[model samples]
Target: MIGERWINLAVPLALLAVPLYALMADEPFTITLATRATILALAAVGLNIALGIGGLVSLGHAVFFGLGGYAMGILAFHAQNYSPLEIGPLTFAGTKSMPVIWLVAVIVSAMAALLIGALSLRTSGVYFIMITLAFGQMFYYFAISWSAYGGEDGLSIYVRNGFPGLNTLVPIQFFAVCFVVLCLALALNAMLRASPFGLALNAARQVPQRVETVGLNPMRLKLMAFVISGAITGLAGALFADLNRFVSPSMFSWQLSGELIILIVIGGVGRLMGPVVGACLFVALEHWLGGLTDFWHVWLGVVLLGIVLFARGGVVGLLTGKAGPHV
Candidate 1:
């Protein structure tokens, strides 16, 4: 067990080093690519809590993601305009600090998840999936119609958000920010998995009736997981917007939600670090395929279909032996 834990921890840390090395080697392409993988993996980790561990199939996670991006975009717009986002007398503006952006993203996403989860949890299986997808589409359309922040076009930041002690514009420093956030998300997931609530959540996923019989409310457990998952994913969205120095309604689309789910599925459901491994593989495939051919997505689809049908367990499951306890 100790050996397993060390390996688990070491693998991600070693993976983290790759970006730094790429930066030192002046491999700008690889550095930026790795940074993206890190951020996406963090988002996947958040989804894993609800979809993998809690057994909730949420197809609308992009709602929270887009919300986070919009939070950053809107704030930056107001800041640049030197005007308050006003509704009558009440107004607010954006901040340049990453921490502030992260906090707002978390709060907004958490609240949205609470409301969405409450409604979606009323159903199960395919119904839940459809409802969540609908909610996501609702937000996507809203963004497209709302011209306040570039609407269908998008919003761009004049500069990347700042951190207190770091020059975020530097590629290495920005990668470090993403790396640290990813580590924090992983650590939080680990802690939650080991907690009693996590145990109940896992149980609720496998045996809701038994959980209820044991006097625990499965609904509440799932809802809590859903909210936390949203918050984590939202933070990733904030980082993503900063990475590109832009935000758009496209980020909230159903396709983005599908991709997040795909990451978890390809990584190995319910496994810690599975998302990280999967994100690395996914991004690498995209980069390589993009280089090889313009229609890489066509080939990528074939590969993903093969994994879904033949692999049964994802890449991690194939490598690690599936009989071990869930992460």
Candidate 2:
């Protein structure tokens, strides 16, 4: 238990170095690599709530992620075009600040989640997964067919989104935002796990019948958790769109959804810091393997197969044992 605590504490602090190293590293490739890894980890953390704790096993989380990215992209486009988004009667525009983009991302993703969860939560097991995946594909196709924001090609931003006090375009500063957000997500996960609501959610995951017997509607609890999960993942998506200064349908694809699951499995399902560690290891492996061979995914597949076959609990589980009961 003490070892677990130490690992838990050490992991976040160690992650702080990612931005610093990226800034000071001589190689630009390494810096970009770290930046991408941090953002991906943030997305995985959001998925963790639904998959790890709620046991929802949603295969279409990419929908929320893509929604968040498109939020950023759409807003940035409007802002650049200096055009107002005309609603029924209210005309809206965009801001250059990151906070504004993040807020919009959260709201949009939450609303989408509420809609999807309402429909999808009506089903269970394979049906739920299929419904979620179907929703994700719907969004993916919409993005591809919609020509407003570059359609299938994608939309790019001339400048990185700004923060009040930092140079958003600087690699280190941007990475710091990603790292800090990742830390915040982990902290929030820990807090939620310890909260009463989190306990109920976890109980629902283990035994919905028991949770329902205790006067809690498992569906209500799961739906709430799903909304929160989608909002968090959407925030990560906003940052991701900014990281690439672009957004495309690819962000909403089933492949992206699968990768998010792979992150959880590789790190240690239900572990707060698992996504972070998994993201780092995954990025490192991809980098190294890519340097060695053109078909790096072939090697990555082999490695992932090994982990799934030999490692029951993933990297974090191997290092720190099973997560606590709450997790």
Candidate 3:
């Protein structure tokens, strides 16, 4: 059997190779599909940090995801419309720059995580899940009612945000952008998982009492993990919006959050490359199977059930002949 580390390395390289092949084959749509997988993988990576490593089973991650999308949409929307964004006494101009939009997305998502986690982290078990879901639903409805930015119908950005030295309008170039960001996010996850803070967070998840006895605040650690997760997910959301050139209330839907969890679950929780593998599988299934039937979700559910009952380690775990640790 192959080592999981090798499998991990192969997964990312395979993702990269596919799009490169697509580019050479003049398959622009394939590149787009790969880019979508990359962004979803990035979002799952964020959730892995929280639910996988930190044991925070949140269901409201769509809040951060939608916020990130809206951040980019609102900024690009204003830029294209030749209007300024006004927040009370302060007046600011919108930006079409990817860097600027990403920064705003990360900061806003992190701040929202802090506030939501501060409250939600106080609860445990199913209550935490419910509260997070409630928050997600709240945002979903709010986005629907936000008529300024197209409200329930969503907002569209006519132009893809500009990235320095890259022609984002080109499919391959845009994919490169998402791929690079995904790699960076993966690197961050790797470092965070192996760091002292990660160990502490894991400890808090595994045994809060022991962590507390050691003069550490478990809640604080969890909160930080949640914030980091949100920031990464938010960045993915921004990229996703750019990919589609649109943002909608559906971005905040509970279904999106559930899918995020499914990606992690199917990929293998707590593993560094779990989300990547999961996202690839999901996109592949969605693309290929979806063409055959509208009830692809039923197949997806069957797959999920099998993974839950027969192979708790997920795809990665199965390949390595080991079931990974559950959250």
TM-score of 3: 0.99
- Rate residue 84 of model 3 by lDDT: 93
TM-score of each: 0.95, 0.95, 0.99
Give the deviation of candidate 2 from the true structure as CA RMSD: 1.9
TM-score of 1: 0.95
Cα error, candidate 1, residue 238 (Å): 0.5
Top lDDT hit: 3
Off by over 4 Å in 2: 323-327
Error of 1 at 218 (Å): 0.7
Candidate 1 C-alpha lDDT tens digits along 240-272: 999999999999999989988887777777878
**Candidate 2 at 92: error in angstroms?**
1.1
Tell me the lDDT of candidate 1.
Answer: 0.87
lDDT of each: 0.87, 0.86, 0.95
Which one wins by TM-score: 2 or 3?
3
List runs of model 3 lying over 4 Å from the truth.
Answer: none
Assess the local accuracy of residue 85 in candidate 3 as a C-alpha lDDT between 0 and 100. Answer: 97
